[model samples]
Target: MSIVVSLAVAVAVLLLMPATATLRTRSPSVLPAFVSLPSAPQLRNRLMHRLLRRQARDSRRRRSLRLVDAMVCELRAGLAPRAALLAATSTLTEPLCPRAAAAAALGGDVASALRADAASLGLPLLIGVGVCWQVSESTGAGLASGLDQLLVTARADEEVRAEVAGQLAAPRATARLLAVLPLFGLMLGSSLGVSPLGWLLGSPGGWAVLAAGVGEIAVGLWWISRMVARIERDLMGHVKGAQPR
Candidate 1:
C-alpha cells in the first residue's frame, strides 16, 4: 500500500510539471536547430582560406613572370638557348628551375619541361613561353625576339586583368555592404532600446526569425559571389584563348 501511494504521488508530480520543463530537460540531447548562430567564425575561416589562396597564386604568377623576363634578358645578352635557360633557372627559387635545367642539359625537349612546370604552377601565361621556345626550335627563329614579345604580351595581359578587377570592385563591395546592413539594423534597434539581440537569443520565435535572416544572407552572398566568379572566369578564359600564338 505504501509503494502504491508513493507511485501515485510521483505520477501526480510529473503531471504537474510544465511541458517546457520536460522539453528543456531533453533539449541537451537534441541537435540545435539554429543554423545562423555563431556563423562569423566559419565566414572568417572561409575568407582567410580565400586570401591565402589568392596570395599563393599571385606569388606563383610573379615568380613565373620573373623567370621569363630573366630568360629573355639572358638570350639578348648572347647566351645560347641552353645557357640562357640555365641562367634563368639559377634565378628561380623553386625545384622546377633545377629540373628544367637538367632537362635542357640532357638534350630533352626543354619546352616540354617548361610546359610541365607552368601547369604545375597554375600559371597559364607560362604556357606561351614554352610554346615560344618550341616554335623557335622548330622554325630556326630568334628565341630572344619570341621571348621578348611574350614578355610584352604578359605585361599587357596583367594590366588588362587589373582593369577588369577594378571594374568589378564596385559590385563586390555592394554585395558585402548588403550582407552587413542587417547587422547595422540590429545595432540601431539595440540603441533604440529594442533589445533585438536579447529577444533573438531568448525567444524561440525570434530564433526562427534569426535563422531565416541568416540563411537568406548566406544564400544572397553565395549567389552574388558565384555570379561574379563565373563572369571573371569567362572573361579570363577569353583573354587566355585570344593570346597571340
Candidate 2:
C-alpha cells in the first residue's frame, strides 16, 4: 500500500509539472475562438508534445548549422553552387534535405523548394539559405560569401540561445525541486508511521487539501515555464539580432 501510494503521488506530481521550453522560433499559432485552460491530463499531454517538438527543432537547427558550414567548405573547394548544396544536404537525414538536393540536381527552382520545405518542416534556418540562393542567382554574387556571413549570424544566434538556456537552468531545477518536495514530505510522514497518504486519500478534508495543493503547484510550475519561454524569445530577438517569426 505504501509503495502504491508513493507511485501515485510521484505520477501526479510529474503530470502536473510543465516542461520548460528554451526557445520558440516560430510565431504563435492563431488562437481558437474560445480559449480555456485545458484539463490537467490534456495540459500534461500538450506540454509533453511541446517539449518533444522543441527538442526536435533544436536538433534540426544544429544540423542546419552543420549543413551551412559544410556548404561553405565545399564552395571554397571550387564546387559549383548547385553541387555544393547537393553535397552538403546529402549529409543530412531530414526529408527537407533530400527534396532540396533533388531540386538542385534537376535544375528546378531550388530556392522555392527550400522555402517550401522550410515552411513544412518548421526549420526557419532553411529560409535564410533559400534567400541566399535566390540572391546569388539573381545578382551573380558568390553564394559562398553569402553563406559565410549567414554562418556567422547563425553561430551568434546559437551562442545567445546557449546562454539563455544556461541562465534558466537554475530556475527550472528549482521549480522541479519544489514540485517534488511534497513527495519527500509524504515519504517522511510514512517513515514516521504517520500514514499521510492514507489520510490524504481516505478523508474528505484531506482530499480537498490534496486537490488544492496539487492545483496550486501545477499553476506555479506553468507560470514559471511561461516566464522562462518569454525570456528566451526576447533574448533571442535582442541579443542574437534576429527576431523569431
Best-performing candidate as measured by TM-score: 2
CA lDDT, every model vs. true structure:
0.74, 0.77
| Candidate 2 C-alpha lDDT tens digits along 1-245 | 77557757766765664432211112223112112334456666877998999999898889989999999999999999899988898777774476688889999898998898788778778899999999999999999999999998888788888888898899889988897777878887886779886776555566556667767888998898898889878876777565443
Q: Among all windows of ten consecutive residues in candidate 2, which has the lowest summed lDDT?
A: 22-31
Query: Residues 22-104, candidate 1, lDDT per residue (tens digit)?
Result: 33322232216653243544566677899899988877777777888899899989999988888887888775455467878
Model 1 bad stretches (over 4 Å): 1-31, 35-38, 92-98, 105-108, 230-245
RMSD values for the candidates in order, in angstroms, are 13.9, 9.6
Instruction: State the TM-score for model 1.
Output: 0.75
Q: Highest lDDT, which number?
A: 2
Task: Give the C-alpha lDDT of model 2.
Answer: 0.77
* Model 1 worst lDDT window (10 residues): 22-31
The residue pairs in collision within model 1 are none
For model 1, the local distance difference test gives 0.74
